[model samples]
Target: MKKMSLLKVDKLTVQFGGIKALTAIDFEMEEKEILAIIGPNGAGKTTLFNCVSGVYHPTSGEILFDGESLLGLSPEPVATQVIPRDRHAEFFCSLGMIAGTAERIAVNLRLFQRTEVSELFEPFGKGQKGSSAMPHKRNPILAENITGLARTVRSYVSPALEDMVLWHERDISHSSVERMIAPDATSLCEFLLYRLAKVIAGVEVDEARIRANMEITQGLVFSEAVLLALVRSGQPRQKAYEAVQRCAMAARSGQGTFFDLLSRDPLISELLPPRELDQLFDLNHHLRHVPTILDRVLHKE
Candidate 1:
């Protein structure tokens, strides 16, 4: 009995318009054996892979699997078996998701920094003028940079998804796309992660501004709390919901503060006294469970 080679590439050469990308490369792999091709950038590793996977028509050479010629076969079979394993799509998709999430966070941070108070994030750099002509400008350029980088990272998702549906068993269509996206997307995501960390670490949060913004809704944010309180106080669920909705709508349309609207509603005042109603509007009521949630999330309790 003899061990058989699972894959073999002999005398492989690939050329691109008179430029030889791969020159007489030879390699073999046995079943269940791992092989790594180590080289610096532009050392033809990708070209060699293309030749072996039938993405590029080799100038000369042969590829064999278990002694059968792979030259005339569709690229899918070879590419699927030798190049991209089952986890390739999952791995890249995860990176795209991370990039997208980071992008969203950066966008939100930028928006917060631009709001009227403009105190969510401290002005970038001491005396760092946002505009030369204006002489009184501060910008969220770091967040903007993350946003731009995320665009490039997100663009790679389509190709990765398309690569998941190669023709028959494999096709060269995804080859060029993968070659560009795989490295670029992962690299962009890496940069985004680091950039976000730096931004978050250096960011100066305005607790007062956060509290001020939370109050902008003018007690309407506590509508859910009021509703829950009404229900817990033995009010019919639908009645409680309707009462909360009416008050919320009035407050939202600038009729009055939600507390005032609810306080004046005869149906609500009968169920809860003014003091209890005021307690329902307290921000602490909504945040009472924050510590528990944080503990669960951080695995601390």
Candidate 2:
């Protein structure tokens, strides 16, 4: 027996007027997995997606989905964007009811104020009002403007409805809109899943990057440990507080470390030596009762 990937794209290529969009691209995705395609602008991210989703037949190469070739099949059938009014709205509302009812019973109380809850059902609003001084203003900061643009590009439904009323040049009336949606939606869907796959896998965090971020935090990372140690020692609370503050300032200025500042302070040096102070910052410190916690959680007494 052999394991196989759910989707494999091999040597996919696309060209427009000698401008090579994708050249010899190869990638694969396994079952129950997500993938992401990322690249800089003009790097064929969308073009490759179009090829995979059946929108643009690759100038060359093979696309295998579930071990079957998807080439030549219309991408339109593969992706359908809809705002199914009755069915979709009913389904979403029903889901909300189920979740809402469960939550209400769990809390044994009515949650949220009446006015606050009404906002979700309000009619969708659009546009921004410009200043009264400018009557010709047409501000474009509309709610869901991006969403509307996305819908227009990949999920528009109005053209099909409007076409039903068309008489002559009826074919041209709908053909233009269909052409855009068919390829655009298909490519967008492909790009979406490709991008999602990378997220699911968790982009590899370069150890170098993590180390760089850690450096920026400076010695402030040890603040809690220092604060707790000050509380634990027999020193009066206010005096210990001021000493730690001075140490932090010196550390931030790159003058000395937290321990160095503490060492110079005659009071702390006499009371707490270096060896004991080291214990406070040790990384291995844990919650002390791991087994007891796990036993309660897993029900394995």
Candidate 3:
């Protein structure tokens, strides 16, 4: 099953001088499955793409496509990276929208605003057809390029939403640059995904690494557990708030686990029994809602 499933990257890394941009990154994709790599900016997501697609070779580590190593392949050598499925739809949609809108805008400018194609700019000869020996020669090419670039800009508009997901992460930093890159990344990724899906197989999942990532969220994820326990007991809101806050502070400071702190605190222990407390600490308690949420989304019921 694993061997038939296709293109996978194993331990890819990119370094710039002494700094490691990507540190031993690993990824894989099964045929027709959509995998998204999302993180805060500077999290090495794009660097991983560049390495896998062969635009840039990792300073160290390996990329494999269908059991063949693509470590040294350049962009031109490898089949182009396929565009992602959603982005492909977006790109074509934007293209059609731009072409229709441009024609209408051009008509409006020519009729109501007293604008002509020649009069639109200084480079061309007034009222003359396109000329070969002068600057006018490039105007059509320039206009075409602008039209294409505009379509590119309109695609991948979703990432702007993703960019704003971070509370304090909002800065004009992504705004100006995302103006150009968001479209290009979406368009290019969609293309690559399309081309590679058939030829490539599947991605490798490193279970140990995934488990390690989940570990980092440990005590932070337990905040809801503590809150629910306090609420179910019918305790006054302020009292519950104070107890949870005190334990959270202790946990944050590395004094002890939140559950341990709650167990030791006489007031909280009085409010909840040991069995209920243990249930609150279990990670699976939070995940019990997953099947319900997934069913609602998939069935739309």
Candidate 3, number of clashes: 20
Cα shift from native, residue 253, model 2 (Å): 2.3
TM-score of 1: 0.65
Off by over 4 Å in 2: 1-200, 216-218, 284-301
Cα lDDT tens digits for candidate 1, 1-301: 8766899899998888989888898888997789999999999998888777667788889999999998976555544443663446777778878988998989888888885866657337766877789767677888999999998887777667767666665668777877888879887899889989989888888888878887899887788888988999999999999989998899999999888999999999999899999888777877899999988988965
Judging by lDDT, tell me the better candidate of 2 and 3: 3
Q: Which consecutive 10 residues in model 2 have the weakest lDDT in total?
A: 113-122
The CA lDDT at 90 in model 2 is 41
User: Model 3 over residues 41-155: C-alpha lDDT tens digits?
Assistant: 9998888887776677788777777778887643442222332234334554564455445534434323321222222321233565554567434243323433444455455
Instruction: Give candidate 1 regions above 4 Å deviation.
Output: 1-86, 117-119, 165-173, 248-256
Superposition error at 79 for model 2 (Å): 38
The C-alpha RMSD of each candidate to the native structure, in angstroms, is: 11.8, 21.4, 27.9
lDDT of each: 0.83, 0.57, 0.60
Given candidate 1, what's the lDDT at residue 103?
Answer: 87
The lowest-lDDT stretch of 10 consecutive residues in candidate 1 is 78-87
